[model samples]
Target: MTQTPSSSGREGGRSLKTRVKTARKRSLSSTLWLARQLNDPYVARAKREGLRSRAAYKLIEIDERWHFLKPGQRVVDLGAAPGGWSQVAARAVGAEAGRGRVLGIDLLEMEPLPGVEFKVMDFLEAEAPRQLMEWLGGKADVVLSDMAANATGHKKTDHLRIIGLVELAADFACEVLAEGGSFLAKVIQGGTEHELLARLKREFAVVRHVKPQASRADSAELYVLATGFRGAPGA
Candidate 1:
């Protein structure tokens, strides 16, 4: 990872923009991505603060604004590989050792964290939700999904895939969230999300979109938060 620096005014000061030299084996896109990651303040902050990913700050910012994830709340983190949001939930709900519990599910293995039970399983699997609920001991007070399908570099296909993932997450959340619970998921910037917002409005008292400062300005990612779940339609 070679870095080329620009003019700076202060001691050890460097331009926010980091430039990387491309190697024979690395594509220009990958090199650019590496350069961005290297210069991202949130990435550096995550390391200093002992968080798993810079994405953790996005959760922190949203929760701080909305005042959700209280102590003793049962929380579920879907597609929780890397376990950044799981860590935040565990701390918020006092899950280190108490009534509050956090369960995380993902297809990828995650390193263990205090007070978080992580299962390497696909949430789309038929039996996964039941297992997660059993670990939580009851319905969840909050459900979070940072899940996204691997980008295929085709904007249209990528948007559809993420929307589908969010819809699946919403369905799972509605089934397992206690009345008055909350749901939050990452979504791409696009038109299809309107339908999702409408569906959520039917079941939640408040629904809103949030773009945390942690999200790269150039990225088209945002989070949709719905709170005060009104319970299943027939319940």
Candidate 2:
């Protein structure tokens, strides 16, 4: 992997851009994405810091502001491929110190990380919540989802698809989060639907949107954070 340039994509007062030549088999979009990854400071930083992926910084930034993910807490990370969020959670919650526990679930198998247990299964499966709780030995203190649907060219359709994912993740969080726990999930610029936002407000004491600096300026991705979960009705 190429070493990351400075945050400004410059070094020693010289601008640097990693350009990718289009391969015969590679599409223009793929070439552009490769180039962007090569030039992204966060990507280089992640490599230098020995982190799993760039997504780790997003969680780290949010947690730094909120001071969530305390020691001895339990955390759940949905769609935790490459284990970036899981890595951050494990460290913040002191999982390596055996003070906390982290569970990472995804359809794709993760290479594995200390202090984190990876489960290769669809989080959308009917029994996923139950199984996750069983693995964690109880409810989680924080539930995170960085999952995003593959975008179609249609903007509205892409927004709806991501909202649908957030709704499902919120529902799952409610099922498995302990009282006063937190839930965070990825959403986009169009924002979450009214019904879902209203529901989150009712379920959690604080619900708001946050976009970390690690997220690209041109990208519409943002996160919805709901803290102080109030347990199920009549529980």
Candidate 3:
């Protein structure tokens, strides 16, 4: 059985946090990460509730506040590996009943999910737009990108990489979103995305950054939401 983290597990009538014993082969970072996961409420909740990942809660919380995902909304989930956000999208959009469409694209192979179409492809490739359009069958009502580049350990480089990925996602959203659509993407907190923000403002009626509670307090990650797309020409 999977270990469940709870206050009920106690020693001497006092609750204690779960700790991972460091193995000879385990790095300190690996040990700490395991310990954190073992203690995280979202991790336990995801397992209990049958969500694919804890990351699903981040998208759920954001949409709850923003009211983006809805019935009959065609959704595109870029970098949708592990199928967490796609699961939420399917349920929200009623895709299983054919009320809307949900398509997920990622370079990584993902197990199939009901009501969501999965494709293994790199979103940066030239054919990506065409393929996603074919799956969507028309302009999307919502575009979601939880994609992040691998961390390089250097703060500046990592931030720049995520920003670049977000920029690409935003550009793709602009190309394929219907008027009044919404775009949501992950971006790190920093000064780098000012130009991206300016461009989004020109194309979207509102652009804002939201940090979901599911995100660790120490993480610099934030989601950028752009709503009411203006449908730029040539896009």
Candidate 4:
């Protein structure tokens, strides 16, 4: 009797071959993307340190400069697919932080990670924040959203979509953040809506936008950071 290849094994091999062929078909662009990934110090460092994604470095760098995360703080991460930012928050808050927690939510499926809670749901839905608060048991110390809408190749439309998402995230943050808490959300380069900025300025003691070094230079995405929440409109 001869051993035979399993059906799963055969299918896996076929899939691998298809991927190789696809890579070959787009060799130029694929090569550039691969080269950039290979040469990225953050990529190398993430692999060496066993982090989930290179995007982790963005949060790490931001925290390093701003000192937003603390040992026993509660955090909420929106658009946390691939678990990079969640991983960083978990480590910073520690397992025994005592009521300190991190909640990560995304529309896409994500792999399970220890020390952080994850939900597969869209934050834009009205019930999502209520569910998250139930899990958190209280208001968060920081709410961070890196959500970006899929670009449609129309610059104005894309910018407007991103701003809409940012505005929603800000509103959600104002509802869930404790007094003196912080909110950070990704925005586009054309500047945020005047109404939104005005609201932030009135509610927070400090509000500013920053473009992290980890962000691509040509990218229009920036981050709006607001601190010292003064309670939502009616509180």
Candidate 5:
């Protein structure tokens, strides 16, 4: 689903802390999450700016510095839900203006956006790459993944799961991205594993970890950006 750009970031205001009272049915963790959502500046900003989620700012900050998403480029957003990144990508690539295209895929259903084509398909499916390419109508200029596995509350397990997802996303990107394309995915603080990092370095001219200010300082989440993709063999 393509999303139209919302109002510019010019409108802004400070937010007051909001405390959530724990109900008899609400767990402490849920209560804390609610409170955090209520107090988060990015959350308020997203609401004010008519954006999908606070995660949108993370992409905005990263792209502002890196300048990867460009006009008339096709972009694919893996695991896009609530379409925050898709929204940003559509605007950056001018999809809404008909200059570019944006395709988003996820297992969960997403509400339609103005400049996005969305599909409900699990990225883990074996035919996913083929299907996504068919939907996109060609190779992608950029592939983005903000997917995360459900937290198991075990640091090691969580880290491994996220790395696994990133590895899969990287593999998909390699299959679908055009020459000189780019791939961006979320990873934990430990960063990509040696094998994956080495492969990415070989496939793309530049590979680095990027932390956007919009991301929570206390969160371990980090984005791995790989740019200048070398063409796939026999492509």
Candidate 6:
């Protein structure tokens, strides 16, 4: 089991270690979840690497393979809870050098990060894209979305929910991406909607679907990487 450096109990008003100890003495589910977290190699690696969440490595691995991120680029991160992907993006785009910027948004509140600007709001609302555009200050070089709808356990329904999120993210990307910009978003294994894929094919020079190694084998999630954007109709 791996343990990271932890701040004092007073920091968050109560210690997670104490809560975990109490939960271990009571609930089976809590114990199992904690055990999994402790044993997860990515979790341990993230702690050692100073990453906010294990999910950061997934994006890093994907970008390593695809070579999408570039220095001096502007990026938009959707569903950026816990600031993991934002951290990775900030580093890749050279935020420290003042040549890059990242704007992130999510429905859940995120802890502060050095280079990320995050907002808490439901992205499905109409005004969300407007706000993202305003923050971006112009078109973005890349739009990345790791958004997933809360699962309802019905396989078909859950698939639709995730696809909906992907579609919305794609639509917003089309609106704000500069020519030759890229869009990366999560989708299910069953594949994307035909209409959506058709649209992407028409708009992007290359549209490839990939499943990163860091994504769990049993999970249905995959990512769609679309590059070389063509301006949308009437844009």
Using TM-score as the measure, the top candidate is: 2
Stretches of model 5 off by over 4 angstroms after superposition: 1-15
- Model 4 spans > 4 angstroms off: 1-24, 27-31, 96-99
Candidate 2: tens digits of C-alpha lDDT, residues 1-235: 2322346776798878888999999999999999999988899899988899998888888888888789999999999999999999999999988999999999898997999988899887899989988998999999999999998989989999999999999989999999999999999888447778899999999998899888888999988899999998876
Estimate, for each residue in 1-235, the C-alpha lDDT of model 3 and write its tens digit: 1223333455797767787899999999999999998887878888978889888989888888888899999999998999999998998899989898899989899998889999898878887877777777888999999999998899999999999989999888888899999999999999999999999999999999999888988999999999999986875
Better of 3 and 4 by lDDT: 3
- Give TM-scores for every candidate, taking all chains together and pairing residue i with residue i: 0.92, 0.95, 0.93, 0.82, 0.92, 0.84
> Which RMSD values do the candidates have, in order?
4.5, 2.8, 3.5, 10.3, 4.3, 7.1
Q: Give stretches of model 2 more than 4 Å off.
A: 1-7
For candidate 5, give the lDDT of residue 235. 88
**What is candidate 6's TM-score against the reference?**
0.84
| Alpha-carbon deviation at 226 in model 4, angstroms | 0.9
Please list all clashing residue pairs in model 5, or write none if there are none: 1-116, 1-117, 1-118, 2-113, 2-114, 2-115, 2-116
Flag clash pairs in model 3.
none
- Candidate 1 per-residue lDDT, tens place, 1-235, comes to 0111122323556445666899999999999889888877778778877889988889988988888899999999998989999998999899997758998988888999998998888778788778777877778999999999899989999999999999999999998999999999999998988889999999899999999877888999999999999998786
| lDDT against the true structure, each candidate | 0.88, 0.90, 0.88, 0.78, 0.89, 0.81
Please identify which of the two predictions, 3 or 6, would achieve the higher lDDT against the true structure.
3
Residues 1-235, model 5: lDDT tens digits = 2122243334456444677999999999999999988777788778978789899998998898889999999999999999999999999999999999999999899999989999998877899888888888989999999999899999989999989989999999999999999999998876437777898999999998899878887899989899999989898
State which candidate, 2 or 3, has the greater TM-score.
2
Error of 4 at 66 (Å): 1.3
